[model samples]
Target chain A: MNGILLAMILALLIPIYEAWQDEDIWQKMLAFASIATKTSIMILVVSVLRDDWMIGLVGVLILSVGNAALMLLAHIIRRLNEA
Target chain B: MLENLDVVAIAALLPLTACMLVTQVDPYHALIIRGILGAVAALVYALFGAADVALTEALVGTMLSITLYAIAVRSSMSLRLGTLATAAPNLDAAVPSALGQQLFPALRQAIKKHHLRLEVLPYASPQALQFALENKEIHAVCVPAEQLATTQGTDDVAAPYLLNVRIPRLYETLAAALPPELVAVSFSRALRLTSAAPPPPDSQLQNALEG
Candidate 1:
């Protein structure tokens, strides 16, 4: 669980790191999105750390739904490619 | 419809678009389509109530279509689609190191200290930098030590400033709003980088000779 949380935070930083290095349009977009998601994760982490069970539960639920959608999108793309 | 275009931009784009539609459908071809769409879209935005969507759809549609078409072509050519897709932003362990951030402030400081007349453009690249210099828009570039050698005048012109700097993280550049890659190379009315005349004699050396 802690490892998963760490992975999420790292994901946010990678873009910020990339944005700093690259001046390309695509690189910048990736960076902005990274910062936004990182900020969101911080809020979620703080809520969990505070033992606010309600908010933490909501955060988890949202994350799960988002992750599921991403997986679903990947599957759809794969099928599209095959078709 | 029939509004708001320089004859030049239109002329450049028309044949370019027609050629792409008829022949090689590459990413650059999409760029021509995008410019055409953007111009058309801007007109539609001005004409009707849906200005924002019109603006977005015009630009987005052109760019996305170009990208999608390009991707499809690449796929047909057996190139992987994974390269086309951008990953979602994730912020798991971003500590925000200052190394990446300092390049901008260091540039600003150089400009300020030198009293240089330079303005970094939006979306400027090294090639653009060389072109601007070639056209005499600006005189000098304050870039990384590595970039100095790439200047057009290494054979004739002597670059006086090759500033090495470490800067602080000034903003959340993750937004890409900052023109970080855009470094200005400037010159006074006096120190032209591409001057046809021979360089002025060194002031200290001249004074010593006279003395």
Candidate 2:
């Protein structure tokens, strides 16, 4: 279980590096989306590994709500470009 | 201790994302990185058996704060430029007028380097435009040299358009970036309280006031 979690953490680093290096706003936003989703999934995996329902529920909430925030941010950025 | 390697790795990501957020130069980019930081923070909190803290971090710290900050940065980081209505008839149109063709693109390009948006507002007369600048309603005013009485009979007459910027930093940016042959950029400290009455254009003043 720990090995799987470590692998997921390694997967997460790919987007973090992308976000840090990319100069384009859209690319950074894509990286943000990747990070947001990956972190919530990691949370879920950890919750399951420990058999903690409370942590699992929080992970589910973040997974759903984080995307909504991402959508709102994307709309704002699109509108910004239009003007 | 080796069994806890995953926890150490996950916890380390929190500081990494925070550093990324702080190092970002652009406000919009920083806001995106802030969202990334919030995500990593929530993950770290959940890993440490603080589910409630994780949820709060995700909901308020990540979602609500980033949305609000994005809106704030978008609206505040723009330069509001007042121009004569007659000079830029098709400013908002797909194909701008000849004057706008010369001005807007160059202005936009210059300010874009600083990550600031250009918002062009039209006024019926130069007085109203100047009034708007003095009132802090706009950051700068761009008018034809012939239209402004104060600019007439000066060396600036060689230039067709005169751009009066109230902020020194904006003046420096425009003066440095814009071609002098295109426009004359000057800085004015007109924001000071003045006893002189505004040029009597009651209707235009009303429009400026409302806008």
Candidate 3:
């Protein structure tokens, strides 16, 4: 368990570094969506381990809905860049 | 199991690393990194047995705020224009400094006409002025009109032809209003110019440069 936690923490740095290196706005948005997905998955994993359905449901909500707003923003930025 | 606790500990550390990384990146990049940081925070909250807080972070911190930042970044651009004013005005003083006497009024008019949120930054010397522009610290440098004709002949100043990024179309407009002696050189072109040769001569930017 301790090892998994360590790996997960280390994994977060990957996206941060990706965002840091890229200048394109779309790529940055994609990195953010990836972060949201990873977080939701982590939450779900923890809830399952703890045998907590309530926590799992919240995780599910984030997993499904969090990216919707980001997609909209990405679209908006794309349109703005086009115009 | 003991293994699960270990996993949670490792998972808990990811967001903290992300939190630090977010600050180091540019504001545009931060917009994206912030979302990931939000998600990592949520997972940490869940690992700590706070599902509710985690969910809120996922929604508010990751989703909502990223959108807000995107909107801000998309609609407007911040410009740092170098100026002669070393400091803010001193109303107590009987006479305004030369920077006040010359630059401010014209800049104020340009800001209103062009709808720019102009910030006047002071540089210690010409080398510092050029360094700041080269490093992308400031958007442009506002030099006295006469300085444009003299310094512009050199390779250093000639590189960009001094076009403003925010108002690419304003070169002609500015030329008319400001004294024929003063000119606003656009520093934003450094990146674009470095990648390619000067733009076509007929281009508006070229017109600004020729003057």
* CA lDDT, candidate 2, residue B101: 79
> What DockQ results do all the predictions give, each relative to the true complex?
0.02, 0.88, 0.40
What TM-score, to 2 decimals, does candidate 1 have?
A: 0.20
**Of candidates 3 and 1, the better by TM-score:** 3
Which segments of candidate 2 are over 4 A away from where they belong?
B87-96, B150-153, B190-211
- Chain A TM-score for model 3, please? 0.89
In model 3, the runs with Cα more than 4 Å from the true position are A1-13, B1-8, B11-15, B18-22, B78-211
Task: Mark the regions of model 1 whose C-alpha exceeds 4 Å error after superposition.
Answer: A53-83, B1-211
lDDT by residue for model 1 (B1-211), tens: 2332322332343344344335423332333334333333332332333434533443355444544654464344220100001122332112112212554355444443322222333213445544554555543334332244344333323333332111212112111232333322332222222212222224434775999
Q: Classify candidate 2 by CAPRI docking class.
A: high
Relative to the true structure, how large is the alpha-carbon lDDT of every model? 0.36, 0.84, 0.60
Q: Cα lDDT for residue B40, model 2?
A: 95
Which of 1 and 3 is ahead in DockQ?
3
lDDT of 3 by residue, A17-40 (tens): 666677777777777777777777
Q: How well is each residue in B1-211 modelled by candidate 3, as lDDT tens digits?
A: 6646655455645656565555654555565566666766777787778878977887887778878877786556534666333233543131124345555566557654554445656764445665776787776666433234443433443222243433455445555555433334442443221212222323645577888
Candidate 1 overall Cα lDDT vs. reference?
A: 0.36
Cα displacement (Å) at residue A40, model 2: 0.9
True contacts kept of each: 0.00, 0.93, 0.81
